[model samples]
Target: MAPAAAAAAQPAPPSLSLPPSQFARLQPHAYLLAHLSPPPSSNQPSIRANGRAPSQFRVTSANTGSLTHTNGSAVVRLGDTTAVCGVRAEILHTEDIASWSVSRPTPASSSPTGNKRRKLTDSTAKLSAESENKEEDGDDESQIQDFSLLVPNLSLSTGCAPGFIPGAPPSALAQSLSHQILTLLHSTRLVRAEDLRIWYQPPNLGPEELERHNENEQMDVDAPQGEVDLEKNKEIKAFWVLYIDIMIISLAGNPFDAAWAAVLAALRDTKLARAWWDVDNEMVVCSDAVSEARKLSLRGLPISSTFCVFEADAASGWRAVVIPDAEEEKELDDSTRKGIQRRWVLADPDGYEEGLSQERICVVVDKEQDGKGKTVIMKLEKNGGWAVDTKELKTLVDISAQRWEDLKQILEQC
Candidate 1:
């Protein structure tokens, strides 16, 4: 939501010189300014008659790992804007162990025509059945923990935002943001893999393992069924996954920051179950020994802040105010259509400012492997291209740096 103070500070806009198509894009912005500068209400967060102060922020809260079935999950609230995240895991399996094993040859094996053929076919069929059962058992062992971490399926639903209809499809923007958040966690190896594993056997010895059982059939001939031998086999590690169903319930503004924050809090509050395999009995046993839940070690928290630059006109008059933070604005009453009328940049801007703004830029900053964080600008096109100059880009970077500093201090106190 736009700050009431910025709205009060802005003047009506002047005549537009641009073509109709250009003018159409600015309409949403006019609506945004109106919303931002709406009559100040007591319900507004940190709000005064003027709307906002330079350092004022909306009310913020964290809902850590709200989903019990999931390995991890979180929801974050910034004023009226909110986002939620959930993490799930699955065990992967493969088919194809038949081609490797060789049948044992013996005098009885090479019997006369009819009996020999029947016996050979029956033996082959039995071997195939045994192999299939073994494969299933292995998968069952692996999936136990994976399912325990997160249910086979989860959905992000309407209660997240106001006026949301149940079973409605998520918007494109919401899907994209969810995908990006999940990708980051997966790519960065954020969660520990061992904590999700239920099997004690080595990775190679499990489903993907290739070897033949001996005549006794206690286990594969080459590899013994014994616990010690299984331990020496190969290993496949398990990792965490977030199945996000992001709904832009209110879309008050600054979605990137909201999404990132929600994801972070969810991960921090996630509880992973601790399990182990009992090799001797060929059974997996989970301890009553659950480890204390721990927060994910975040490299650095990156936040994106948006500012809307509005161009006002003769009819509605020239008017511009930053969406949620309008206090830092200048009335562009006399500026030509080509010049920037009013600049509204600080934190989350309401929808109206978002529509009228010439463009929006998001800054993504993160830590390098060495643990040092750096900021990068992500330009959002209002029409189709980047409109920022080098100097303006630098200014955005500086703003992000300061924002991060403020965020770090707040977190330290937490």
Candidate 2:
């Protein structure tokens, strides 16, 4: 064959471009190298894409009462991330409240003889009667059911990010995020349970007494109508239940902080309608009168701040760890003698920054009265294999306190 024909017959060289998966694996490293390294034009390091310092947060804004139909609603934005929270109020029955109590199933008896011998006896009946008496007399001590039920849910759809699918089952990330929000709400005790309680006077007359009273009233034409009606009695029944739903419109990063802020704003704006028991209908009635409505009692405003931890390169005034071969043992010894590896903590990390981070810490803080007045940490969540020092943790908490104050002021304005 001719030389040209032989050359053309040879297999084409492997494509220079990497496969999508391989490129994704290296993208974070590439981003870190480009952003952390000093710029060629200037000796100083390059600024982040949004021109923000490592420790600075993006601009934040909040608005409340945007959804008229909901009991309360709020939209919070931190840079490009946006979250909307809506609170809906509903009536809760006493039986439903009883079911909310945590219960554990008793294990079956392991021994066959014990199971066969188990039977109700006179003593068991006596014990049951005593328990019933205690319940009727309210002698048994138990936790008071003062607070209303709160249910929080989080949604992450395709519009919120690129990877999420539309109309698909909730991903693990969405469920985990919802669980974290609910945990914080309960642990922090931001909403007072007593504020959600609804009280009314139930009727005291039995069926026979009611029938006789109605007949007497009908027969007594000379009696003053208003005076006779004023002698009736009333009783309290149940309370309100709040359903909090949060949606992520855009997820740049640090969703936990944004979602929490939205929740706080919505809850602060919530107002419960007036409710009363109707003896005639045998049901609870809610008044539509706005004048009778009351705002929810908020215990304390808690705010959160998130930080991403990145491994700093040795050139950035920090030691870097690496396994050494026989020939490189001397370099490893020198690095160890110099110092331990150091990490860089970045605040309010965006999506790209989070991709490069190996660890994350979320700190929640609130102002409380503990010896006059003081700032207290409400919750702290750290994820990753990295361990943080005590001093560093303290510093992070202090920063969270400052952020809390700033966010509190913004929420008040909203």
Cα misplacement distance, residue 339 of candidate 1 (Å)? 9.4
Q: Which whole-number lDDT from 0 to 100 does residue 197 have in model 1? A: 40
Q: Residue-wise lDDT of candidate 1 within 201-313, one digit each (tens)?
A: 44443432433332332332333344424433424233233344343445565665777666656555555444444457544443454464344454345544555444344
Candidate 2 lands at a TM-score of 0.68
What's the C-alpha lDDT at position 92 in model 1? 25
Predictions in order: lDDT = 0.47, 0.72
**Residue range 1-414, candidate 2, lDDT tens digits:** 699999999999999987645764676554454454433344454345446766778899999999999999999999999999999998875546554344211222323322332454788767756765555333111212233367899998577888887678898877998999987877776665556655564344564665566665442233333333323332225657789999999999989899999999999999988887776887788888999999987877888999988665655442344435645645555325333333557789999788878789999888874655488888888888565777888988888888887898899899
Error of 1 at 210 (Å): 20
Among all candidates shown, the one with the greatest lDDT: 2
Candidate 2 Cα errors over 4 Å, as ranges? 1-27, 37-49, 96-148, 202-236, 313-342, 369-373
